[model samples]
Target: MLRSCLSKVISPCQSAFIPGHCITDNILIAYEINHSLKLKSCGQERSMSVKLDMSKAFDKEAERCGSISGFRIGSRGPTLSHLFFADDTLLFGKASLQEAQHIRTILDLYKAASGQEVNFDKSAVVFSKNTDPTVRRSITQLLNIMEVPTHDKYLGLPTVVGRSTSEVFSSVKERIWQKIHGWNEQRLSKAGKEIMIKAIVQAIPTYSMSCFKYPDSLLSDIQSMISNFWWGDGAKRKPIHWVSWDRMCLSTNDGGTGFRQLKAFNLALLAKQAWHIATQPSTFLHRVFKAKYFPTKDFFQDESTSRPSFTWRGLCAVRRYLLSGSKWRVGNGLHIKIWKDRWIPRPSIFKIVSPSDALPEDSTVDCLIDKDSGK
Candidate 1:
């Protein structure tokens, strides 16, 4: 009854809180970053993110908290103030005492109205590196929340992306090693190891893979670790590698264990994310990225070699795979060219081959169709 009532009463504008909503926790976290830090010096304007572990959510009064003034990503992007999650809320603002006080005031008002206390001890704040030490000290003192290190995470992902991406995600490797070490104790059969590798090991880096493209060296290192495990005995002694790892990655009908190759699988995961950004214009991620990266053009048409983030790089890197897997829908086919575009379902090239002279190279797909038949 409650769900049914919510379906009608809840504004269609909200993508959450009603029955059969597709806005998931993971999807929300994908937009958790406001993403505007360039490693400034002490005198520059500093930005900070405050993570609040709250026992509860808020009423419309919290929504009406007005602007404490959150930073914007691109010139055209929306200003993000705060994001509320199931267990925590992220508040973004400048590293000024005034901003900190405003945040505090908002929290106090919530505590007064909701009667649910915020876990201040569990909450913490992180600031950009270039922020003045004095400013950082003053804000934390004002808010009464501990200041976290620069590399602190918001929603299990790093808030600050430094120069070294490999170092940033080295934890993925560490996690895999720990899991493998624990599993090695079982002395499982070859069949069991294959299943574990497919299910658990591959899943470990998927979330990270969706955002950042791992360096080739790091991918090689991870592959080496998995390869070592597959070939090694339960003990320290290395067993002989009978077949190559590539061959083992083939399908059962192809005469090998059907393990997914990590690099390709990682690319596929990122491509899926890119696909969402391209197709789902209503998504917050699509709006944010489109504003920052491809303001004048579409996602596929963007080849901006400018100072791109790792997230943008990952999305753009999988363009080839995405293009290869996709083709024109051909509604009127006013836009698609016969020879230039990928419309045909054939292999090697999706474009029509044979004689380019039969139909002019500039001809659109609409030409060959019978006018009345619509074939």
Candidate 2:
């Protein structure tokens, strides 16, 4: 029964516990953050990066307090639920060590009010500069204190000890690609599928490269849905649009495939400072930027930004790609030159202007002139 309950709680594809009940806990944390931070109406500011540790929290104490809590103690799933106060926290944000220390103090107060003292020996605090080393040491210290058996899988399967970070990322990427290849093979292996295979071949460019924790069957269903939406019978066929490497990221827009191009997104997100510095006149960074890059111009005229020197070219490239598109005019009747004759409205002559020309001196009088008139 426990196995069944746990199975229901954590789906096969997911690596961690993510029950719906955690929403309130997350909301409370968000509330705490909002209460702690102060923001001006429209100023841009850089945030400090802080890493939090909460591995040593006591589940039994939380259960005694009457709040059900669940989390992957290490890296496994189904979450091993107890009381709400038992869950460990891992928070990372842009903030200084001093600021993080202040937040930690506040959290300790909050935890005490709720009848819990953070197991300090098993917990840790680190700034962005030392987070990796801090995390490794903290995890080792936490496992030792908990007396986790060498062979016992604490959270996920027994950790593959000594795997480097690159190895981990490579393994994850391999698994995702393998799943995609398996899915494609399954679809192509069916009988009477040569034509379907051809169609699938053509649609490969539009194939989603995004990773998801969905089961193969569910993913197949989603693909079928997309196929139907994009190429169903008797539908007007439109060209599939391809996205640039940067535009393909999910965070930039709502409708992108959930693929997060990590490095690209990081650069794009950082590029936000260019826009901020360009627009926010009152900020100290803006003043510095103006002085360094645009000594003669006011903030409105200053296009100078604090973006890293190397990224300026890529940023310009993305901007150009975004703007390079065919212009179309809307009309009452549309005409296809090759398929149908021209569709015309009431005939009128329109004068085109050169880039350097301003509006004609008497625009209304120009509109009144006959198309063929010598006047």
Candidate 3:
């Protein structure tokens, strides 16, 4: 009966504590007992007859708390209570005493049940500029977590608010310079240098590049480093340029070494993200973006606001490339606009007519087809 309960509690994918693998049934029972105790301490009104499952309980409580006292980004779907990536966790809630106390209770319960304590010293609670200091202090004292003046690093990228792309990527530039200084350029052959440049040096700023369109100065700096290294330039000897950097970045079949142009590659990566946003609407990231930026409109039709995030600006900058290549395939003709949408397959023209020439503001392809017949 215990085994059956345990199996139900833990799925096959989460079978970390396998039976007969230095783990006993008593240990599993102890875990369930601990969970019940924690739940009781957390002010759960359930009787002892009910078995406590942490994951489901956590989700339920979080959802309830979020619905009551959370700042929601959109009017659609379930309110985002929390997000977990490996060991890192990000919790979202409205800045209120009730919400803070509820979060504290949940955290304490988790620690008691799992015997894994959160390091409050390492954790930080950041509030918006308009948030009251007194409320921030109260919440800080309640959670025993430090209050940060500004958000620093998230994942690996810097949490850029209004900073320039170059300022945000200063650390990446320093790292690349350090790598170049560490390597012995004279000792490496041309082929060896090319491999290192392509594999290591050029790949350094890829993460940042995917998110933001890099400045010309930064791209040129990186290109210069790779070019110098490839030509075996060192402290004592100066290297000669055999070919222009642009030509060198072209394909081998096009009469140059197969090297990537940083700016082009960065644009391509952002375009891929734009493509995903168009194709994959069910994804969480896609929904979040749709809610925040382009709610009630499609990607191409969405106009940029007076103030947009650096990442959003980057995506919009490369949106033209994606739109230029895209052509709509008429299915029901309800979704495609007659003049605005690119439905026709032609070399020079895709739309039936220009916006000025097209009549009726909300015209669609359905206007050309008979409603009763399946023409």
Candidate 4:
């Protein structure tokens, strides 16, 4: 009976509690909004966001409040009430008393239902500039949550991003340095060094690299550090330079140690996000991004000339890999452009090098497809 009555449980698109979603998804959504608005230079907005570090609380359904249903991300964006990334929840709305009161009422309802008080001390509210101070105080007083300029980090990733790329990401270098320096290199073998590099040092930037492309200078710095750790003995006897860093970054099949080049690794990591967006059309992330960035065209056709967020910028930068490496299946050639879209099963240019004189500008591959054979 339970199986018979089991309804399809649809998750809230805005929430990151759904499967295949992570804390990074939440951070990207929030960061992209501000970046599109050039918020880094202005350091402000007219809205406010409440980051609630709730206790070990279970889920409980509550009556919806129609008066204020959080805030709409952009004109075409979805109305996001709250983003639930694992345990963390961020609520957004206009910097107004009504919204604050609504939030307070919802929290009260939550406390009443769950019988657990929210940790307001750990909670914080970040606002955009030009938000009225009076309204801010009222909201903070009502919720009893302190106001903060930014949330900084959520789930080990930066919730806030600015123009200074290297400065913001300097902590990555610091953590790597600490790990490498703390180890006793004297007792380790060449095999042991390889393990240390692979298991520990190389894994340090996995999360960050998955989100943004590192600057060339930063990648060089990190590469130099890794090289030092690999070559330098425990004591200072002046380690000799063995092989070029680029050569070392080659694959085992290429007669090298298979070290990861930071730039290529970072791009590969960022490609994961691009892959998600390109393939997962039904995802909440796909919906949000599609509405704002590529309403008409798909991911591959998208231009970064639009006021792109840092996340989008990173994705756009890495998109070249997708364009160069992939092609359409051409199951039905109606949608595949003959001259522009990459559909042919050939190298480099996936599209065919057909005679331009015979084809129209809007011609598609359907003409060449055999209707009976379906090839």
Off by over 4 Å in 3: 1-60, 64-68, 74-78, 236-238, 353-358
Q: Write the per-residue lDDT of candidate 2 for residues 205-238, one digit (tens) a residue.
A: 2211111111234334434433333232323454
Which pairs, if any, clash in model 2? 48-94, 48-95, 49-94, 49-95, 67-83, 67-84, 69-83, 76-155, 76-156
**For candidate 1, lDDT tens digit of each residue in 1-375?**
687688576432234675443333233333334344443335556788777888665333433565466656567875666655456567666778877877777778888988877887888887877778898888888888898764266557765566787898899999999988888888888998989999999889988776667888888888878888888878887777889989988999999888778889889878877887788766555766777778766678745656666677777889988888888778777767788778876777777667468878778888978889899
When summed lDDT is taken over every stretch of 10 residues in candidate 4, the lowest stretch is 56-65
Candidates in order have lDDT scores of 0.72, 0.33, 0.61, 0.74
Give candidate 1's TM-score: 0.78
Q: After superposing candidate 2, which stretches have Cα over 4 Å from the reference?
A: 1-48, 53-101, 115-172, 180-317, 325-353, 357-375
Which clashing pairs does model 3 show?
A: none
Off by over 4 Å in 4: 1-10, 13-17, 34-46, 56-63, 236-238, 354-360, 366-375
lDDT of 2 at 355: 22
Q: Which regions of candidate 1 fall more than 4 Å away from where they truly are?
A: 1-34, 39-46, 58-65, 128-134, 148-151, 303-305, 330-375
Best by TM-score: 4
Candidate 4 lDDT for residue 205: 88
RMSD to the true structure for each prediction, in A, is: 4.8, 18.8, 11.1, 3.6
The superposed Cα distance between candidate 3 and the true structure at residue 30, in angstroms, equals 37
The better candidate by TM-score, 1 or 2, is 1
